[model samples]
Target: MTALTLIRHATILLELAGQTFLVDPMLDDARSHDAVEGTSNPTRWPLVGLPTGAAEVVASATAVLITHTHVDHLDDTAIAFLRDRSVPVFCQPFDVAELTERGLPDVRPVDEVTHWRGVAIRRTGGQHGTGAQADLMGPVSGWLLTHGGQQVYVAGDTVWCDEVAAVLDVNQPQVVVVNAGEARMVTGDPITMGADDVFATCRYPGRRQVIAVHLEALNHCGLTRAELACDAAAAGLEVTIPRDGERVSLFQG
Candidate 1:
């Protein structure tokens, strides 16, 4: 059975195709790092702690998938956690050099589709922000994981745009994972999906599941699960906002 466990922030433990895949693990303790410069609500990063211990968190076998190398997505503790292990690290081309430099033995860049043990992981494009913010934020990638008759889309740090629309129209994944914290810098628009964007994703014409995450962890993330839940419910939109450590089914609901 395909399942997902939200570890914290943008981190997730995904079980699919008879293997476990850890995605963008940020395993540091609460408030260990300072706030991201220029972002609003200048509080320390990772406002909360992981639901479980790091060792227990990553004890399962399989590989690691990193969408980007942002501190919130990939930190020193997480890097140190994987250094001695022999799991394959799958990442976008932009992160290959650094991840390898960090001493990860099996660093693999998924420029496009990467096949592994009957699973297909396809790299999809996205805009982290608009204009200068987007450019400065650098390149981000979402991932489409397909195995047999099931498909799951892990939409990385991104806003609602043509690229996301195309992924929805073309891929038609039954389960969609969205970074919906509405995070932003000092003086710009939201860098991630807000309530409107999440609603847009849920409103897509089909039967599927929209899982909204990236909330209540960092200071810059202005939106909360309570807020999103109320807004979505009022708008008659369907979404699953799981708490940290909660395991969610990958099937459409």
Candidate 2:
């Protein structure tokens, strides 16, 4: 049995093929920092607290996977936590230098197919947004983890675009993890997956499971689980909406 636990926002604990990975950990407590400079909702960060046992989850992880270096995804608190451990961190090439400069122990760039602890891993491409917004958001990466007969794709911080479609077409993963918070800035469009994007991804022609996360913890993230669930159902898409601290499992036959 493989399990994915939604700890909060973009942080996830994925236990697959007898190995554990902690993805994009933001373990800071509520109101830890100022909100994005210009976002309409300028309240202090993390509208909610870190889930119980969040520290334990960090300590138990066999490795760390980071999609990007945004504060909401990889905060100072999480960096400190990782600095104290001896775990390896897998991330996109762009972030390798930054993480290493931050004093993380073993920061490995996922430039190609790599195997760690019996699992096959591939780094996938994604655009944070289009045009100017994309420039501001910078580069991000998704990950494909395959072990045994099951494949899981973690589609990190991307909107609906041709790259995402290509990933779906080429990988055909059994499970797709989506960031569906619809986070936006004060002047630009949404920077992350909204209900529309999530609905579209889930409607792809397959029986795969969609795990919708990255919702409701931050002030700028306007999308809610109830809202996405309603919209997804209307669009004939099935999604697993896990609350903060909820755990869900996938089995490989």
Question: What is candidate 1's lDDT per residue for 48-128, written digit by digit as tens?
Answer: 999999877667749888999998999988888798789988999979999999999999999889999888999998889
The number of residue pairs in model 2 that clash at the backbone is: 0
Q: Put down candidate 2 lDDT per residue, 1-253, tens digits, no spaces.
A: 6999999998999999888899999988899988877788878988898777556868989999999999988988888888989999999988988999999999999897799988988998887877799888898998999997789999999998887888788878889999988988887778889888887788776657889999988888899999988987787777999998898987533
| Pairs with backbone N, CA or C atoms under 3 Å apart (clashes), candidate 2 | none
Off by over 4 Å in 2: none
C-alpha positional error of residue 114 in candidate 1 after TM-score superposition, expressed in Å: 0.9
How many clashes in candidate 1?
0
lDDT of each: 0.90, 0.88
What's the C-alpha lDDT at position 237 in model 2?
Answer: 74
Residue pair clashes in candidate 1? none
